[model samples]
Target: MTVTAEREPAQVATLDPAAIAREASPEALSGTSRTPALLIEHLSKRFVVGRKRKPVTAVHHVSIRIERGEIYGILGANGSGKSTLIRLVSTLLTLDEGRVAVFGHDIEREEMRVKRLINRVSVDAAFFKKLSPWENLVYAARLYGLEAGPAQREAVRILSRLGIKESRMSRPVEQMSRGMQQKVAIARALLTSPALLLLDEPTTGLDPRSKLDVQTFIEELRADHDATIVLTTHDLDEAERLCDRIALLNDGRVVAEGTAAELKTQVVRDHGGAATLENVFMTYTGRSLDEDVEEESDDAE
Candidate 1:
């Protein structure tokens, strides 16, 4: 199980469901006099690694802001701090440096409130081998303080919408495909109607059809549920297809960021490479991990 830190810093907000729903109001998604759904400023995290026990920087001073109803993608190779960054936002890891705010509430100060407003779906969907999809989701919903009857009905609705047959939801989750299991995981996370959904490699390790199904569901969630998503992915095409904007991370820092077209144009015009996400990834991350950070010039078109 993914463990999140559980300590209050005093003066935390209420965990009331209505108060959390106000955070996801239509005006909030419209961005009219509203703060970002997620805001990170100079965020950093380090881990003590190696026999020498020296601290290795897992995430440097990375910063990002995501508006409500936007699918913001974080792209990086393995160990580039993509998952580390997600953990920091989801409260799995405490920040060694910097600040993170969800819907204008400080993560460290208002952790319970933040937890109520967001839910995470990791790449691997964990489930009891003997439990069916409906049973698993109902159990998870009970943990989130939902009545089992309502949660189970909603689970069937969501699973059906995600292309899982209602009949199959009765079968053991262990008997399902990885993609099917992922769909169930997503359904479980949506039980509380999280305003900010943190998707940590949600489509990883799925077969092509399952990958497409999950991708379509992700798109539908943004359109139908008004959920602000922070998605981390290794698939370039998936990012381009599903993300409104993307940040390319390298060596624990954002090396470049922009819309897919903007990034492609930037690489082609500036670096004279083929206009592809592959080129953009290579141009920004191919350098030494210890290289100086790439600076962004605000005047650029």
Candidate 2:
């Protein structure tokens, strides 16, 4: 693979807040180029678990390039480090080694800039349960320094588009179904119109109709808002539908990568497996998606 970026400590230190804001603006996001939306180079992370404190390599020197406007999927079974990689890129966890950049901004050195450019939504999204969906979103908007008037309007619009009715907006989020809460999480993440969105198992646990709605909304975001998405999913069919390219991860390493059709072709020809994602997963990961891999160590960070 090509070196996605060279170390630029000096340049990172000199980036002005105004310039960073400008770079993350909607106008800037409108311009498309060959520059990747995300680049991971030799990224690695390990957690110490157990009474013996043995190290478990959650992510092991994995690298991938996600292009602007592309939906890049990371497909893996449980405990395969998909969430760990996403956490590292979102700065929720510190990496043990390697580098990551979001739209040319170094994640470590230019963290604020990177934060401005990206947003993440995970299955276990946290919210103040007592607050209404609208209130929760407005709070998030205020933190992003958005004016209340426009932010509320945009929040309402996004929530409505996600199938939330105005009547439901004012009710405490704790009363809503898990699927509805997930939609609220998605709407909040989109409030800034981020250039890059990290979605970790976004449609997991949703009813079929709700899942389809979210999936359609994701496609719309990429087509209409010039957003690049990095999605992690165990749903092979969903990955085949949404991802421009996918990386199959196993044991914290990327075992295969290609478009869905490309991967199916390879598995049939090379591995003598059925021309299906299920077989591809079985061939590579050596297990079914529903089978939970027990945590090998006593402590997993």
Q: Note the Cα lDDT for every prediction shown.
A: 0.79, 0.80
TM-score of model number 2? 0.87
> For residues 33-146, could you state the per-residue lDDT of candidate 1 as single tens digits?
356778899999999988999999989998787765678899886678998999999988999999999878789988887887888999889989799988888888887778
- The count of residue-pair clashes in candidate 2 stands at 1
Q: Which stretches of candidate 1 lie over 4 Å from their true place?
A: 1-19, 22-31, 287-301
Query: Which residues of candidate 2, in runs, are more than 4 Å off?
Result: 1-21, 24-33, 292-301
TM-score against truth, every candidate: 0.85, 0.87
Clashing pairs in 1: none
Q: In model 2, what are the clashing residue pairs, if there are any?
A: 50-299
